[model samples]
Target: MKIRASRISDSILIAVSGEEPDPAHQNISRSRRLLKLIAAFFSLFKLLLTRYRRPEFGSLRRDVWCLDEREYFESFQQKDPDDSARGQGGASQQEQRSQRGKGKGKQTARLEPIGDLGYSGSTFFTTPNGKYLIKSLPRRFEYKFFTRDLLDPYVNHMRAHPHSLLVRITDVVHAPHPTLGGLLGVAPTHHIIMENLLYGRDAEGGRFSNKWETYDLKPNDYFFPERDIADGRLAPKSVKDKLVDEFHDHVRVSAANKRELLRLLEADTQLLADHNAIDYSLFLVRYPGPRASTDDGADDAVPDNVPFVDSDASPWRTGLVDADGKWTYRVVVLDFFWARHTFRAWALTSLVKSFNKVAHKGPMSITANPADYRQRFLKMIQDIVVEV
Candidate 1:
């Protein structure tokens, strides 16, 4: 007998023995079974290769891309028993083990709920070390309508560019609900751990009271004063003029800071635009205060009675804190949920409006080098839009 082999398809081969069996007498059913067996074996081989391709990245294996045993079996239900039996049992078992391992990984890092932080059904918690902010799905709901994976890529982007205007996403973990007070029927939650800014207290502490007297504020300046008229010592209009004039000088210094800030914003905007992830709703929180000097040491606290101003004379400082109440003047960027390609215009426009409301006063003009400030901001936005 002579044996000859020939390629049938990319994944199939046929081997024939002897010169050729009589076509009329050929065992057609047997040949068909043999062909089916070859195809099934090839399929199983491909499945194994895909399953073990990135075993270290367990999430990839358990994700929807990989098939479960039941799904695989159901897909090939019409296959012959002998062909399906060849490696089905062993392959199925291995797949189950791979998925089991992934599930175990998720359960071990379960996130504990710390109650509502703000947005509906969005809860906050601290990691085991209590150093990071963990945002997770509500414990009371099963179906999450929001995109959890959207945050993963944003976190990765921030980690690569830590000093960018964007907030930093520290880590991501898979977690399960606490047994008690847990939301019913909710699946294992994916918790995003971020650098928590809430731990730090503003140097001025709380919103500035609008009723406080602004001896230096003009009739048109934006100044928050205490509402209660306990003391009739409102300064005379002449004194207010002197204060407003001096305040305008401080505004000059503030314009310089704003110029620097615009530069930072421009750079960040370009980077985000390049990535094609721009969302106009994205707003950077401005921490208005004098930049802290390292020489000032760590124990510096804002004096309670200092007059509010945009310059270093003002006590408001932005800082970060650990769970133990320790704070530092480190700037952290956060909240990338609204990042998208079209968001730059809205974000920049919002910032401009805010500056106008809080910092800009009288005649809609920049006091300290009007031409320079307007030119810088316009250039910044132009650069951002072009890059995007």
Candidate 2:
């Protein structure tokens, strides 16, 4: 991973707001503006500098920005109806304050692990203010495939279809180093910054909130070792927990809303299949609706990245309220990194075939062909989303 300095400089330039300064203040503002700019530059530089100060390693500090990501997120935020509600009150105010704090003199915030500790090997960290998630790309092939084959197309698709349910990847940071630690998977050099869809669900800054439940859904028709190995007797609790599906109830929405949701999913999955992507899951979240409020402190803040429509009848547009108004749903397709052509996928497919021959079971989710997987995935979701 070669860290490009020019790209970082360009990113800093792009991050600066494009709004013109007021004409009246321009003459008097130049000196103050220059001083402020210099201070901000140093502040950013200090933040980017790694804390590690090993003399032998020569002050390990490498920060490379994925320039295109900045523009992509800028467009995404502008297009996001939820984000547009910032400063107007409701849940957006918390996120607004979080962003405003980041723009101040210097940032002291750091990334911390979310409570769940995801089943995936990669580490998941959330920003201090819970606005964004930082996910490590420990696997070389997955990250390489994303950057080489899918990045540009994904960005273009999101730009064209801003309301698409695909997860918003805000930034990609590459911190290259000459150490063997990164090569051994001890320290991941590549990471992606994504918008936290479940932000503000939990108590934050003394603000209370209603409970929000989340589910990571995927097709479970095939034999799962966690569930099939003598009812998970042979698997560790952690493994069993990760593979088991706990979401038994259907996504109770009206028939019309279901159709719209499926339509969006069809388009999203088609893009993944077109690129040979597989093993993606629907990350669904739901909370009590207005009538079924569980907490008195519950506010009107919506997921920052999810599109909120103004029409009351439109589930997605109306912030995903259910047909009966019992729950509000937030859904996005995630983990579309594994590809059919990848060596890992091929190995998994081979292993599944060998196991299926002995146990008479179907292929695991990861082993399915892109087209086949898309069909099964859609059908599974279709079964889950039923009329209210």
Candidate 3:
């Protein structure tokens, strides 16, 4: 899934590509506009008259709150709402069909559920285009902390530092469904939309043609109930499978890349540490292949939105290659919602300490302090990312 660079002239033409005016169609369009105006007037009148009532759980509006509208819109190179509306309204049936035919390779983004992936009980989903991931915030405190406390800081941080390794969260969709809330104590209605790190890996004959390996890594030099506690050890393989870390080897990169990687990680984790957040993981995806040439005739690049072709250091979407050219690595910091101040975190801290003491082991990663966790996280990455 090579992304072709879009041209300015092509964009300009497409922006103003509405059909020429016809006398017969003019009347229909005028009537439609008049009808729409009438409808809007009535809707406003109805709103003014209707009593202010709290929205019901199931019937509540599914609000799509875009965290960074401009960033994502430009990054995706999506059509403007007005342009889409115009295209739909002005196009003839034949023209509409023709437009659809032209959109052969592109896919309409849709939510597809990806059943249980990790220790975190949150539900997961991916967009049909494989560009975006939707992860549910099953815990109330987690979602509340994100929206109430950390949201502003996170947005500000991302805007201030574009090269931060933190996963890009573009939107938060709050769909209050009675069924989910009523069934589970923790309402899984709030979902976070993020960029998928392993994007384009599954695409046919693209830059990511090589088989990609992924690892959700964290500090393992601590007491883990799955490996330490008796009950956890006795648990089924399925349960233990979720808690395992598959990657154990070091990832070697150029000294410059390593320094940049650590610098970004340090800055990103500092924000999380300040906010008393913990239990974050570095989601790493790597493939054994040479970096794709920019002049590969495809010109598969989104101008200014994606990584710079000239610089070989930080490739945001394309990823960076190791010094040996044995691997192309993409990394994003993930799952930074678990704050120390949260009730669950506090309780778990106590439980973890008691268990650790009994087992005579070190501090558990999930139960460690924000600052301590940040240190461990950085060290974990430093230990693994060998400077070549």
- Highest lDDT scorer: 2
lDDT of 2 by residue, 231-287 (tens): 778878877777735588877888888888888889889999999998899888887
- List runs of model 2 lying over 4 Å from the truth: 1-107, 176-178, 203-210, 294-318
Residue 237 in candidate 2, Cα distance off native in Å: 2.1
lDDT digits (tens) for residues 73-187 of candidate 1: 2221122234321212222323433443566411112223465542334556542222235564333221121133344443344344434444433333332213211223222
Candidate 1 segments whose C-alpha is farther than 4 A from its true place: 1-114, 127-130, 137-160, 175-188, 202-260, 274-333, 338-388
TM-score, every prediction? 0.31, 0.68, 0.65
Report clashes for each candidate as comma-separated counts: 19, 2, 0
After best superposition, candidate 3 residue 169: deviation in angstroms? 0.1
Q: What is the lDDT of candidate 1?
A: 0.31
Better of 2 and 3 by lDDT: 2
The candidate, 1 or 3, that scores higher on TM-score is 3
Best by TM-score: 2
- Consecutive 10-residue window with the lowest summed lDDT within model 3: 44-53
